[model samples]
Target: MTMTAYLQTMERGDLDSWGTPEDIGSETVEGAPECAGSFDLGSPDDPVFGGLYSVTKGKYRVTYGFHEHATLLDGEVALTNEATGETVVYGPGDSWIIAKGTPVLWDIRSDVARKSYLAVTTDIPA
Candidate 1:
């Protein structure tokens, strides 16, 4: 038997994970929202970035054509629906899912905001 594939740093007190930097390109909202933690390079089966992501502070808009699952690890973010003008504030120990093709505004709160996420694209409904 072999015991391998372990993220020891991920088990630390801090939510921040090391390595795995991703490029959001010009899609970043503001304050250079970055993955301050674990970011995967991806593989064949799961060919998408997944891990702890964080943003210092700021607000930005995005049109999500795919589903996104996020669990707030620290700080807070206010998600406002662009279409319906609806908004929800999420904090630590909180989580949410954004529907596909939905327009959203991300309002980052706190000095440094962080979260663990798994985002992917799918044509099917959740």
Candidate 2:
């Protein structure tokens, strides 16, 4: 197998780096976390992209506009589906997916949480 154009090599980037943790938007949720992430690949320019992202311990709600799959690289958390009230817990080594237009609640139960994720967006986020 070979790496493709979708691949990225990550390093510590300035606050202005694309997809860096600093690029954030808000929607309901709970507790504001002191967040940080260094981008490794992709950007708002691509139809599909990914990078490293993290959040401090806190309860929050997230709405997914794009299809995304992620691995829980660190920490423990609970995810609750908004429409069904179904909840699942995830810890290190766990992988999960959030479909486009779904809403989820993230209950971060560790000091910090991290994940590596890939997102496919039909409509790019600005």
For all candidates, what are the clash counts?
Answer: 0, 1
Candidate 2, superposed: residue stretches over 4 Å from native: 1-23, 123-126
Per-residue lDDT of model 2, residues 1-126, tens digit only: 434232224332333222322245534356655566544567746788877667777776667867888887777888898878999999878889888878788788898777778888885454
For candidate 2, the per-residue lDDT at 79 reads 88
Q: Write the per-residue lDDT of candidate 1 for residues 23-125, one digit (tens) a residue.
A: 4322446664544556543421463556666766776677875577878867888989989999999888788988778888888888766776667764664
TM value for model 2: 0.74
Candidate 1, residue 114: CA error in Å? 0.8
Q: What are the Cα lDDT values of the candidates?
A: 0.65, 0.69
What root-mean-square deviation over C-alphas does model 1 reach?
Answer: 5.3
